[model samples]
Target: MPRAVVRQRDARHPALPRRAPTPPWTRWAAPVLLAVTVVVQVATPRTLDLSFLLAAVPPLAALAYGPAATALLGGTVLLLLELPHYDLGHPGESDTATVAFVAALSVLFAAVRSRRDAQLVSVRTVAEAAQFAVLPPLPEHVGPVRCAGLYRAAQRGTLVGGDLFDVRRGPRGVRALVGDVQGHGLAAVGTVAALIGAFREAALDQRDLVGVAARLDRRLVIDAEDAGIAETEMAESAGDTGAAGTAGTAGAAGGAGHGEPAELFATAVLLEFAADADELRVVSCGHPPPLLLRGGTVTELAVSPGAPLGLGLAGVAPPEQTAVGLRPGDWILTVTDGVTEARDASGAFYPLTARLAALTEVRQRDPAALADAIWKDLVRFSGGVRDDVALLVFAWER
Candidate 1:
């Protein structure tokens, strides 16, 4: 049976657990705040000592009811409770002063909350956009190979992380690459972007996978060094003055200088599927070996194991290219450590090869169905992912 068809069938057979519902507290914050206000009122102080607690109520209410309702509730609470505590030097004077202070404070709190909410929304939007642009959607098919991929960042609201994968049909054949930067977040994303760009450019220009890998390594190192120089200059400028900028500058310098070489380096596997020759070639750099699944058996391809790119290691031998003849209906699966390393509640790693073999026996050679079965087993094995997992499967059809 084709892996794609098997994956599609498995996707329809619900396997994973359903997501839990959001808690009541997240839905009804205003009532919670009102209850807190009652408790505070019971324990109120005789003097203006209640000012701090009263001031806190508006922000809490805002979190529950939103800005406008928060302001209204806050204003009403102040008028009913705090107004009587104020002394009137003249007619309507006390009322005017209390109302003025409450209104001002309420508006200030609401404005701050509104601004924060807007900023959060903006960040989420940008993150999603970046993720979509950087991580292009996986193609349904490539040559005789059926391909599917998934990436999930460990951090919430962050779409793109340090992981990346690219598959393209070229003159050489169908080439695919999956890589992970040493760290996470924006800095790692920058390296991923640079590496992916270099890979695409070099892959087209160079027939050798090793050449493509080297080109990407050089690009990443150059970018890392440039960032380091900028940080050093900022540090020196700050040192000349005793301003608060000095601390920030020093921290930046420390982070850039003392950062691990791995943070600058990337682990990758580049694969080439020559459909005409019916062979698969691979080059690995400190990355997990690609698994070749055929006839219900899985084998890790042999490749020269070398240091991850951008470690600045000299005299290191270049990676060796390994090739394997593909049988009809054979499929190659490559993934980052995120898959095998995913742990369950008992801290046991997912047995990817074993699971793949099991699923292969049960499902037909449908690409989609195979992908679905593999992902379901992955989720079940890991219990849940602690980091992002990226998988690329390529199969030869007849």
Candidate 2:
């Protein structure tokens, strides 16, 4: 495989953006402010009255330093305020006492914030690990093309969701997928994993995207059948073991409507960049057509849709595969319906093509920048998305 995978983080992903570091001088901000206060206090008329300013040093220190350092700085401030010569005015006892109290409070605040920050970091670390493990990052470069992907779960506080996309190098070529499982949240994670696994396995030896799609359909159908069998057996076992009164309740409950499992299905777009072929072979399984970005214009690829996976449609007949010619600077952008179907506050659907066209030609080439631009525009348009969004962007490396 002639591709190199790049993750969200600078090829860096998963890790949320952290606060930028403060300048080195900021480390000594509290001490420097204290020194300045002293200089102003002594160099000027003794009546300039800067005692309030002196009290601010320790609290400022707490913003940057830990509890112990904040406490030490607070102590220095208290000493300066109380020391006879340092006290330009015959300072009141209350002024010195207040400064000491504030310093102690700053130390306490520092300790609490420090503890919370550590906890947040640990939790975020675990979440990112799980997300990366379940759905590894897409390839940064597929052959001479640069690839980038982004996924945002509709389920609050979760990194992974029902939507999925992946790009992997294989014997057939570099096959990429953008798919959406039926529902959102962790409940759909198992199906997402199974489909991804099937895609990856098929990509290793399958000659084309059609075969990959067929395999995915089979995997979902098989899983759904197994789940149905388990539920049926459990219902029967409960009916046999329970008292007659309880059995009737269970039978009535099952009869009322819970017996039938919803059909499992997923819409997907699969792409195969065959070896030495300067084009993309695309197969759409009830998925929206991918948009082509070339020469600063966006055009939806004209690919015929077939039945979604899990309906066993592929077994009867393979989905139509369209081969798109690739230009040296052409970019292919595909996404789950979570993006295309997203509606704004007025109930207007998101204008994906219009938004893509709005981006400056230069910004459209960088996958990360493109993702950010679209995402910001999306948020601005919809207030916020309410569904899992999976996006993929890859351009012939320029």
Candidate 3:
């Protein structure tokens, strides 16, 4: 078993309670502060100037025990410091005012902490719902193609990332697309929705796969430019890197021009399979090549060698369609980088081809069964992914 999987299993055991690590500064702050306090009392002895010491207490305590504990500790320290004054009957009015100040500070801290927790919970909930809507449930079969798909997000609470996959049975044939956008979260999901919507519409109207890709590319480019403007405004305010690395890559893949503004592009593999003719046509645009598994052997389908869809770059050419003959008992597997690039704790990539080779021995050849097995193997290999993943498999039974 991979180390990450082992650790995850160990974490789940009821006997073990996960403990948060102690922050280095938090662990030593109180002792250091107390030492300073004592030193001031002994060395200078002018009643010990403790105003600075009192001001530092809340922040230090908050770091150690969280907001509530910090507030409690701050109040306790104040009471202790004021005790000497109270007993001496010196400045009784000032002591009372100090206590009231501590009370107000504590209440403020607690309220802030509560609000932060609520916001985090709300964000997580919304992310989960969005993920389900974008991904949905994979169909057992689409047209004559038996289909299976798998997806994962690199970050926790992010169900849908830049990666996207969709299979549709339409009037033309069985069509599927696996693509990765420039980034993750809502922005990526928005691009995916636009691309999928365009593809669905174009696939029905356009007889050629190239035409479909072109149509989708146009829509994506427009959306990306518009989104980029919004992103730029926000980045200026936040001082964030505005679509630097990922955006550059997306644009390069799409074949954007040198003079063109940075835009979101995608690496995508499009597939159209005609059940009547047992023919498979594929167009790959800067995307990982799909694997065709047959008789326990896996073969990588050739990418049509086309530029990614969005680059307005000059001299960039569109991708061509590559055809493959499909036979009974043959299976076609399509996946995004999230599958092939999945790294375990040891930094070893999952052996997708080898795993699929092993699956040929299984007696069941149904599309769902094949897909499920592949999905399970991928999860086992990655010990759970740190990125979003999508997998699709189609099998023609003998």
Ranking by lDDT: 2, 1, 3
Q: Tell me the spans in candidate 2 whose CA falls farther than 4 Å from its real position.
A: 1-6, 10-124, 237-242, 248-262
lDDT of 3 by residue, 1-398 (tens): 22221112223222122233345687468546755764565466455455446545565554455566666666665665566742322335675576557655755765675567567657655544555566665666676766666555555535567888777775567888888877765557887777878877887887867877888778877776776666555444343333576655554544433223456788888888875688888988888888887775789887667788677423367778898988987788887777888887799999888777778755254655665576677777777766667667777542
The candidate, 1 or 2, that scores higher on lDDT is 2
Tens-place lDDT per residue, model 2, 114-227, is 787677767766666777677886666877668877778887656678998888887857788899999998889989989988988998878878888989999999888777
Cα deviation of 18, candidate 2, in Å = 10
lDDT of 1 by residue, 351-381 (tens): 8887777786544655555665776777777
Predicted model with the maximum lDDT: 2
lDDT of all predictions:
0.68, 0.79, 0.66
Model 2, residue 49: displacement in angstroms?
26
Q: Give the TM-score of candidate 1.
A: 0.68
Tell me how far the alpha carbon of residue 223 in candidate 3 is from the true structure, in angstroms, after superposition: 1.9
> What TM-score, over all chains together, does every model reach?
0.68, 0.69, 0.60
Specify the poorest-scoring 10-residue window by lDDT in model 1: 11-20
List candidate 1 segments past 4 Å from native: 1-61, 64-115, 242-263, 312-315, 343-348, 361-376, 382-384
